[model samples]
Target: MINSFEVKETNEMIEKENLDVRTITMGISLLDCIDSDLDKLNENIYNKITRLAKNLVKVGNDIERSYGIPIVNKRISVTPIALVGGSACKTVEDFASIAKTLDQAAKDVGVNLIGGYSAIVSKGMTPAEELLIKSIPLALHTTERVCSSVNVGSTKVGINMDAVKLLGNIILEVANNSKDNDSAECMKLVVFCNAPDDNPFMAGAFHGVTEADAIINVGVSGPGVVKKALESVRGESFEVLCETIKKTAFKVTRVGQLVAKEASKALDIPFGIVDLSLAPTPAVGDSVADILCEIGLEYAGAPGTTAALALLNDQVKKGGIMASSYVGGLSGAFIPVSEDQGMINAVEAGAITIEKLEAMTCVCSVGLDMIAIPGDTKASTISGIIADEMAIGMINQKTTAARLIPAIGKKVGDKVEFGGLFGYAPVMPVNNYSCENFINRGGRIPAPVHSFKN
Candidate 1:
């Protein structure tokens, strides 16, 4: 029920506010592709992905042209490879071979990135999952478009300190291997607690077991659009400001609904949820931090930053849920340092710190993301950071993730340029104090008491 006036407004938003569909992701299930033989396993994985997503890019293009809307990325998410390739990928190199196949499939289909090179070890790890985790450094270093993620904790299962410790070392290894690209490989890797099933966003997207054989999920973003709406009420009350954001989010989500339905129909796949996340970009005017500034903060990490972010995230969800029957994924404000220009500025101005970012994540969509820390930061410190975020997610029963890049050979104040969507980041300082004893104690942190409900 998009009326003429709404259509015109959407057109204006696209032209002026940097509004668009961030991604049209096709989730393909690879459960049936499992084979005990490594060669056949890879062949099945490649064939299934290519067959289902062959027209994904083309359909996205047609939608963009027909509706005069921009579609930034076309992505694919598959079943966690640890489950699908467990029988076949007996060694770390075997898993890396499977990653190569995924990279090739992405290139063949002309998609921006392919996800689900992942494992779920919230409680404990199986042999296959351990193997896949071990291969992440080499796999991400060798491949171009493949993304990897590991879920080391969840509300129901608690934190797996063992997996967290291993991933800390693995992330450092990934950075070391890809130092030539300023640790670009780490940009494609995510460490998660309570990861979502139908996330269309990259670096953490994986097709959950509950999903259908194939589906289409769209992630729509417009932080700039929200910021523009807020501008119309400079001196307004908090209630008025919240209303403005809700109305703007409603309008933005309707456009997403249109794109999702059209893409699903065109592809003959079931229409999955439309993720109403206000995902920011490196481009000017499209930042969650800027939206916070519009809320009267001098800089992003000013005193009231966390409160502003909470309001923005909650209102966006309220508006979006009313606009569409289905709203899921990390549908809130994202505060990735490298991807948001205002956040980058804040870090450079010394207004934002890693600790402040951690506090912000208590209310935002995800945890510390695309943050580059000094190269000398120890693996134990990284694990400590992950442990803290995981504890937050577990206690809050929300999805949180960390994509930390230990910029090899770089120190505080040095800049790491990853380019493109990965963007660039200044090396932020980490606490020099040691958390070695805590991380070295390898065991599961017990699940929250509320999780025991039957």
Candidate 2:
């Protein structure tokens, strides 16, 4: 099954490039855990997660050893807790306790992060959902490995002003409470439109209602591989470069499909989606920004960078679509500022700015991720940033999210270190324009005009 050119590329990926499977997520549906009795519900939650994911870490390690490809993270995304636990609780604290239990379960199973402690309040918020939203600060602050998200808007229902309002305060509280960690807690939270279920990525994954009781999904990452593929044709035309990248992505996604199929068969779980995100680690050779730079941009924020990213995203999808029928998630390149070394270097070198990053998000996969801003940045300014990204997703009918950290005691040009996969970032400046009146409107922006097409 191996052709000469493809084998050569694969060898280059393993030897010179840091190509590897990023994550193998187990989507465990927790709907069956819901119960009228709080104690029974918690017991079911722990038992289900433990039973499904007890051997996940071992299996991932064994596969890595067998294939010589590193699996960066082992993660799980459960059904939205608000749906399962919302009706069982009356107080925010009660819901937070449930989050703590989930965190412990993740630790027990040897997974680094567990997602789906979230609510889909795009249309409206129920009492339990409201309580959970308000308790996110405490839950995320107290738990080490729990990731939370809220889908406050979607193409179908437009943006929810009430949910958006609460998120501003929630983000502020999460930041302020975790200020000792450079507001690292805020990094664990994401607000989005059209969030995906089988996303084997962190901070924004939730098991959708359409999924089976349990399934295995894989996230494949190889920015270095794609960049290396582009390097061979340095002076090639743009069309040639696009072809190279597309061919490389096809190979990478095929590897992902192979790995997911094998992992699913071994675990006796149904195979799920292959999230073809160019997820970068804090390692030396896994930079998503490096892909952009190698694609002929001086750095990720150069004048033509957005156009380059748009092309890259399209070609990647085109190749991946041919590779597998189960493609989903943010399947293009990621531009998380603090997570990629080249992005950190770009920000330090004055090649990228917050505004340009925001503009780039219009075309890229995720929006304004892991950006550090001045501690004194007003909550309203943060709200304005969220509103802007939400507007892009709402209008384009794509998924976009913001994860901005207001680092306490840090200013523009100052750096905040979050250690490990979170990497580091110099504070990026936000515009001084006031959005008080707009944010203060305190009412929904209403569903976009496109939503009425039905």
Largest lDDT belongs to which candidate? 1
Pick the TM-score winner.
Answer: 1
Over 160-227, each residue of candidate 2 has an lDDT whose tens digit, in order, gives 76787778778888989988888889899999977876778889988988999999999998888888
User: Model 1 off-target regions past 4 Å?
Assistant: none
Model 1: colliding residue pairs: none
Model 1 lDDT-worst window of ten:
416-425
lDDT at 179, model 1: 87
What TM-score would candidate 1 get against the native? Answer: 0.99
Where is model 2 more than 4 Å wrong at Cα? 2-8
Q: Rate the local accuracy (lDDT) of all candidates.
A: 0.94, 0.87
| TM-score of candidate 2 against the unseen true structure | 0.97
Residue 264 shift from truth in candidate 1, angstroms = 0.4
- In terms of lDDT, model 1 sits at 0.94
Clashing pairs in 2: none
